[model samples]
Target chain A: MNIQLIAEIMGTVAFAISGAMLAIERKMDLFGIVFLGIVTAAGGGFIRDMTLGIVPPAMFSSPMVLPLAILSSLAVCALVAWLYKGSDEELHGERFQWILNFTDAIGLGLFTVAGANTAIDSGYGDYHAFVIFLGMLTGVGGGMFRDVLAGIMPAVLRKHVYACASLVGAICYLGLLCAMPRGYAMFTGAMIVVVIRLLASHYKWNIPRVM
Target chain B: MNIQLIAEIMGTVAFAISGAMLAIERKMDLFGIVFLGIVTAAGGGFIRDMTLGIVPPAMFSSPMVLPLAILSSLAVCALVAWLYKGSDEELHGERFQWILNFTDAIGLGLFTVAGANTAIDSGYGDYHAFVIFLGMLTGVGGGMFRDVLAGIMPAVLRKHVYACASLVGAICYLGLLCAMPRGYAMFTGAMIVVVIRLLASHYKWNIPRVM
Candidate 1:
């Protein structure tokens, strides 16, 4: 399988798991958890497609992605249920949070590069702001929606360098795309995001609070 | 010149004002207020167009709307700034809330019909669920985004009969379109939302919360 395809599926699953876990934390029902998971997995691409004017977004175009998202969500739910054995308190501990953060950073990096490549492929590469916006949104939009649904401030706006990491990855992807093979640029760009995001969280870095 | 055009502009302005007020309440900067205002003014249509596969969205097509949204937000900011003379407390009275609610209801009703009509014009009239979904999202999406940005739960999910009222209006528009003239249907549908929303607020009608 192509790296792009693998990244897409992996990112979708990772993001879906993160979303489902947050929904569980929120005490949402099964349907809500599943719904939140699907939206979080797909919402960024949906927003990016809308911005780029791609009708019926790729989420709707390919039947595989939606089912994959659902399956991933179900798997996550089942695993978490078994691990916690229906104990909500156990699920809320620090260990699960570290896993969530690790997976989320990976998803952010993968989705950022994927989104940047899509925008470039769609003839938006020349517009740096547009490409960056699409890439950043594709990385962070789903999580923002998840946070909103959970009634919390979006981490992208307040948390440690999350959106900034995506922005850096997108910029790197676009910059390297002009000089290197697509695969190399994609790999390097995604890794940059993952590394920076991990470092930022570990160091407790955050954008300064204005208010 | 037409009622739809009038409604679109009016609703945009009303929504912008509501968003601006919320931004002020949150003590956001001028940039945040304007950003929230523009998103609230145009976010719904953006979502609807994406669903229908309209690339680039109507927001880009008409340069007029973006500027108009900005202008309205500025006007609102200026008015509130002047009214409060830079004191946040002065803007927090009960009267302002009543006015906010009054304008918000009108915007919701107008946006619901406009969204439904757009869906119908796009050949989604036959699919009642599609029309209803488009219409309701167009009405509620902006406010939801605004609330999320302000770190609060969306009113549609928590407030009295808000989404339900929009749903009623959207259903009414679709039903009436099957038998009546477009103008009549639009007017009736919008009025139905406005009246019901007003009555619901006055009567303290709320969807019951289970947990």
Candidate 2:
């Protein structure tokens, strides 16, 4: 499989699990759980595709992605069901945040590079902000949707260095592309985001709230 | 000016005002008010455009729409500021709901036609679901964005028969187009949505909560 495709699959799986976990935390119905999980898995790419004017999106154009989204959602939903099957107290627990953060960070890293490269491949190489925005959206857009649907402000708006990490990763990828081959540059960019995000979470680094 | 243009303008104004009002209710900062207002005015079209593969969107493509969005947002923000200047008690009052519902209904009517027409023009005429989905999204998508950003459940999910009204209007428009002129069909369709939405609100026709 292509390296880009590999990154995309990894990102999708990680993001889908994170979303499913959030749905469980919210105590949403089965429909809500499934819906939110699918949305979170696909929403970022949808946003990026839409912003780039790629109509029908990859989810509709290429059949594989949507099924992957559904399958991953099902897998995550199953995991959550099993995890909380015996106890109601664990339902509202914060114990899962560490695992969620880890998976989310992995997704953020891989997606940032994928989104930035996709933009560059689409002939938007000259537009710095466009590439960065697409990259950031691909990294965080699904989580934003999940949060919004759960009736909470998106973490991107106030959370610890989420968008910042994506921005940096995208910029790093774009810069590295000028000096290195695509594969190496992609790996470096993904690492940058993963490391930054993980460190930020561990250190509790946060963007100051405006309000 | 064209009838479609007139409808678009009216919808923009109504949506912008509705967004501004919601921002005020949330006690968001001035920037949030402006951001939410602009998003509400153009967000639906943005979604429609993206789904249909219209890149850069009309907001950036035509130039005129973005300014119109900004101007409408500013105008609405000013009106809200003026209205609530005297007291904070009335700020949280239910008095604004009437005006908000009226404007939202008008927007839904116009945007549904605009979205449906755009989809048909894009060669989606045979796909009934596509046309209806686009039409409904164009009508409610902006408000959904507004509500989500404000961290609330989307009104279409549980509120009055808003989605029903838009769906009926889109189907009506599509059916009418087979026999009538575009102008007549469009007018009739918009009226159907507006009337149905108004009636739904008046009668409190709500979709029951599943969860």
Candidate 3:
């Protein structure tokens, strides 16, 4: 399989898991949780494709996206159940949270690059600027959507320069798009976002509150 | 003033009043009520314009919409208060509901004609069939929006087939454009919707439930 196809599957899996975990946290019913997970993973990409006048968005066009959504959601539910088993017994477990956080950071980093790269490669009168802008948005947009449906303030509006981290990743990807060897640029872009997000969270960084 | 502008203002006023009354029923704060009212009144039109590629939308672009929103909301609040004071001990008033239903029918009828006419008049392509479809939606879409935000089932999903009613109005308007004089066609079409809504509601004529 092509690298782009692998990237798409990885991104779908990462987002679907995050989406399902949120629905479980929100105490949604099983069907609702699954629906939310699928919507969250595919919503941004679906909208982006529709806006670009592309028919049958990748989520619907690709067999892999649907399977990934279902599997990822189930996996997330099982993981959450296992991790939260101790919640009623005593304190919330910190160990599971650390692992969850680690996986999430990797997901976020990888998704950002994947989204940006796809926009750039699509080559439908969308050049560098549109690609960078749209890519960063596609990466973070689904999470923002999940937050809204779950009736929480979006993380973009709340914490840690989350969208900016995506932006920086996009910039890194662009900088090295023509210069570096193929895989190096992708790796560097993902690394930038991952490190930035981890560091920003640790320091409790935030964008300036609107005046 | 343009005839189109006048019609738009009338529609905005009717929609805003309906929304404000709903917000008051919910016992929201004054700001919340006004905000809900204005957004509900204007949102569908704003969306319609955007999808038609009219950026910033006339509801935001034209100076009239915001002022009309504030005016209509305040007028509705004041009128409701006056009606309550003027009524006797039973206090089971439905004058507000009657006014909203009446004006809402007119607004829907007018908006559908305006939307389709504008598309045809603009020398827009055959793709303007989509714009006409949008127009039909814009008429009833605001109420659907208000219902969802108020935590009620959307009227289009439940009531006297609201979207279908608008579709009927659109069809009549199209027919008028084809054979009859527009003025006669417009009035007859509006009457058809208003009379149908009133008669349907009186007999508890609900749409059949589907899976």
Candidate 4:
């Protein structure tokens, strides 16, 4: 699959899992859980599009977005059901945060490359390095918000190297797009982020306090 | 003060009050409460301007908006602290939903008229009536969202004729703008909405059920 398609699938799966876990944890009504699942999957992209001045936003205007959201929701529901069936502990009680980290890393990697490419193509100034950075942040910002609203520690703040990975990839994307094939550069950037994030997860890498 | 200025103040006060109440109920720290308060006071207006294709998002660009938000936050926090002083029971308990209704009415009336006038002044056609109507909804829509997120029943879903008051005033303003003096018509629309909303509150006027 092309990188765009791959990124879309990655973002959709990660977001869907996050939503499903939140719904099951909160014990929301079935419909509410489904609604949240959809929102959690697509909400970040929606916000990103709006901030970029994409008229009419994406979810409402795109055929693929809704189907992707629905499929993602079903995938997450099935996974959670199977996992919960095996154990009596809550769906989001203990293992949820760990799931969130992997999902978040996937989101961070894909969205950083996507956002950087989008900015470069939009005829915005190269100085919109800031916009690329902002887009990467916006992509994961919604989940951070969701966690805060749910009164849990935000994954980004959990010494998880969350935003750092995105920042690195975004910079890498811009640098590689300067001289290389766009596809190669994007893949390289995304892979770097996902690997760094997962390695950080395995080794518990975190920024030390400067003070 | 100009009527528009007065309306803006009323809307800001109401918006801030709702934010403060939610913060207190959520037990958020002072910084979190202030952040919510600022977003609450400015959020609707920001949405309105952005949808209208105005740039820089007036809330961020205009110095006046920031101070207004701060003042609104101060007013709400001071009032609540005074009223519920030493009464932790009421402060942290299942309180009645009175203040929500009060602030919602004022916000709905002010924003609908403000939005309609802005649209009309821009020389857009009557099809833009839908846009003005949308602006009215966006004003109250954020609060409805806030309440829902706060786990309270949405204010608009209640029996009160909230959105109806704004809709009526917007229509009345559109009608009378052509026949009467412009300034007079503006005042008349504002009064009509306020009076109707207050009457609805006291008499429990509501749209009949769709069954």
lDDT of 1 at A192: 96
Alpha-carbon DockQ of candidate 1:
0.16
Candidate 2 A-chain TM-score:
0.92
TM-score of each: 0.63, 0.63, 0.56, 0.62
DockQ of 4: 0.04
Model 1 chain A lDDT-worst window of ten: A202-211
Per-residue lDDT of candidate 3, residues A1-211 (tens digit): 3766765677677778777766766666555466567767776676566566443456755768777888888787776667566464322256544543454556566767777776766774247777777667777777777777677787667767788888889888878878997467877887888788888878887678689
Candidate 2 lDDT tens digits, A45-138: 8888877877556655554665676787777767766766767677566678777778888888888899887898899989988998898889
- After superposition, candidate 2 runs with Cα above 4 Å error: A126-133, A175-181, A205-211, B1-43, B50-117, B124-133, B145-153, B156-211
| B130-165: candidate 2 lDDT, tens digit per residue | 687689889989988998898877876556476778
Clashing pairs in 4: none
Clash list (residue pairs), candidate 1:
A53-B55, A53-B56, A55-B53
Q: On DockQ, who's better, 1 or 2?
A: 2
| Tens-digit lDDT string for candidate 4 (A1-211) | 5766567666766776676667667766666666666776667667666655786766677667667766776677777777778664665474676786677667667767776665555555344444454456555665666666566666654444666677778777778877798788878888888898889889977553201
Model 2 chain B poorest ten-residue lDDT run:
B202-211
- Tens digit of per-residue lDDT, candidate 4, span B53-149: 6444455555565567667666666676777777766765544245655665666666667667666655564765674575466456656655644
Measured with C-alpha atoms, the lDDT of residue B114 in candidate 2 is: 89
